[model samples]
Target: MRGYWNWLFKGDRPGLYKFFDRWFVFHVLVGASLAMLLPLSLQATASSILLPLASVTVGLSFAWSGSAQVLLQSAEIEQLSSFRVGGIEEYVYTFQTAVLCVLITLVSWCVAGLGVFDLVWPKSSIPCVYGMVCFLLFFMSSVTVRECWHVVVGAQQLLLLRYKVRMDAEKKTNS
Candidate 1:
C-alpha cells in the first residue's frame, strides 16, 4: 500500500503518460493467474473476488490520474496569459462535476431500488443486479477517460503560461 501511495502521489516529471502504471495491466493478469491456481470447486467465488480486486486496481489508476492533475495545477506555472482561459475552463469543469453528482444520485437510486426489488421478489432482479454490477464495473473505468479530459483542459493553462513567457522575452529583446 505504501508503494501504491508513492506511485499515485509522486511524479517524476510531466508528460502525456505521467502517472501510467504497468501494474494495472499486470494486476488483471495476476488475478487471472491466481484464478488458475485455485481448484474448480472454489472457482465460483474466484470470479466474484476478481471483480472486486480489479475494482481496487481501477481505483488506484484513478488516484494516480487525479493526483497528477492536482500536481499540475498546483505547480508554479505562471498565470499571466494575455488571453486568460483558466476561468472559462474552470466554469465548464465545474458544470461537468455537477453533472457527476447527478450521475451518482441516479446510480445510487438504481442500486437501492434494485436491492429492494431483489429482496421483495427473490431471483427476479438477478439479471438486473448483474447488469448494475457491469455498469459499475465500467463506471470505474470511466475515471480514466475523465482523467484524460481533465488533462486536455488543464493543458490550456500551461500553454497560456508558455505563450506569456515567450512573448515577454520577445518584448524585452526588441526593446
Candidate 2:
C-alpha cells in the first residue's frame, strides 16, 4: 500500500519534492478549477462515466503490460530493457496503473453511495463540505485520466518500437 503510494507519487525519485511533479500540480489545478467553476454531481459522474472509464483503462493497461513483456523479450530492444520509470519496469508500471484506476473508481463509488444517507450538516458548513467532496471527486477523476493517458502512451510506444524493429529487420534482409 505504502509502496504503491510511493511509486505513484515519487516514482524512482527520492524526496517529498517528487510528489509535486508537474502533472500532479496540473491535475490539482484543473480539479480545483472545475470544482469551483462547474461542480459536478459525484453520484451522477461516478454512476455514468467513472466505472466505464476505469474498466476501459484496466483492459488497456493489461494489453499494454503484455506488449511491454513482448518488447522486453525482443532482441532488438535488449538494450532498452533497462528502461525504468521511477525505478519500476514498464510492465510493472502498467499493472500498477490499472490497479490504481480500479481503486480510484471504487473510492468514487463509495463516495457516491454516501449520498444515500440523509446525514445533516450545519447549514453554514454544507456548502463547504459539498465543495470539498466535489473537489475530491474531480481530483480522483483527473488522476484516472492521467493513468489512462499513461497507458495510451505506453501502447503507442510499443507500436512504434515494433515498427522500428520490423523496418530494421527488413533493411538487414534486403542488404
Candidate 3:
C-alpha cells in the first residue's frame, strides 16, 4: 500500500491537488456506498453540504486569482495561446464569479444555520446530520473540481504541444 501510494505521487506532489483527485474518485464510489447505507430521500441531504462548499471554493479561487494581483502575476501569461481570452477577460470573469459565489454562500449559510433542514424533517436531528454531510460533501467536491481542472488545462496544453511539433516538422522538411 505504501509503495502504491508513493508510486502514485512520485513527485513532491501538490497536496491539495492530490487530495482533490482522490476525493473525486471517492465521491463517485461513495454514491454507491450511500445507496447501501441510506434511503434514497436521505441522499438529498448530501446537497445540503455540497452547494456551500462548492461556493466557498469558487469564491476563494476567484478572490485569489482576481483580487490578489501578486499571486496572479506569478502565473500570468504574457500572451494567451489557446483562446482569444486574455488576462483582462480572466480578471473580469474571476471577480464576477467570486462575487456570485459570496452571495450564494451567504444565503445558503443563513438558511442552513436557521434550521431550514429541520423545517423539512422536524426534530429528528436532520439538521445536524445534514450539516455534517454537507461539510464532507463540500470538502470532497472542492478538491474534485480542482483535480479535474488539471485535466481540462492539460488538454489545452496538448493542443499547443501538437501545434509546436507540427511547426517543427514543417521547418525540417523545408530545410
Candidate 4:
C-alpha cells in the first residue's frame, strides 16, 4: 500500500515533496474557491455530476491500463533504449498515473455518495459540519480532476512514444 501511494505521487520523480507540487496547490486553491463561491448543494452536485464523472474516469483508467500494458509488451525495449527519455519508467509512470486517477475518482465518488444519502451529517442541526463536509467533497473532486488530467497527458505521451518507436524501427529497416 505504501509503495502504491509512493508510485501514485512520486513515480520516476526525485523529490520527497512531489505530492505537494504546483498542480496540487492549484487544485487546492481552486477547490477552496469553488467550495466558498458555489452555492450548489453537495447532494445535488454529487448525484448530478460527480457520480457520473467518477464512472467515466474509472472506465478511462481501465482502458488506459490495458493500453499501457499492450504498448509495453509490444514495443521493443531496444528501440526505447535509444531514446533519451526514461525508457520503461515512462510507461510505468503512465500506468501509475492512471491507477492514481482511478483511486482519486473512487474516493471522491464515495464522498459524494455520502452527500447524496445525507450521511455526512445532519445538515439542519450542524450547519458548520455540513459546510466542512461540502468543502471536503469539493476538494476531493478537484483532486480527482487533476488526476484525470495527468492520466490524459500520460496517455498522450505514450502515444507519442509509440509513434517515435515505430518511425525509428521503419527507418532502421529501410536503411
Output the better candidate (1/4) by TM-score: 4
Q: Clash number for every model?
A: 0, 2, 2, 0
Error of 2 at 18 (Å): 7.5
**The best candidate in terms of lDDT:** 4
Better candidate number, 2 or 3, judged by TM-score: 2
Models sorted by lDDT, best on top: 4, 2, 3, 1
User: Candidate 1 regions off by >4 Å?
Assistant: 1-125, 156-160
lDDT of 2 by residue, 71-147 (tens): 65666555444553432243455556555665765666566646531144321458777667667667767776666
Residue 117 lDDT (model 2) = 17
Better of 1 and 3 by TM-score: 3
Task: Name the candidate, 1 or 4, with the larger lDDT value.
Answer: 4
What does candidate 4's lDDT look like per residue over 7-95, in tens digits? 44554663234446777777777767866776766666676775577677777766766776676665564357457454565556546
Q: Give Cα distance to truth, residue 152, candidate 1, Å.
A: 6.2
Q: How are the candidates ranked when ordered by TM-score, highest leading?
A: 4, 2, 3, 1
How far is 41's C-alpha from truth in model 4 (Å)? Answer: 3.9
TM-score of 4: 0.68
Candidates' C-alpha lDDT: 0.42, 0.61, 0.45, 0.64
lDDT of each residue in 102-163, candidate 3, tens digit only? 44544554554565644665434565565454554343444345533533344345445555
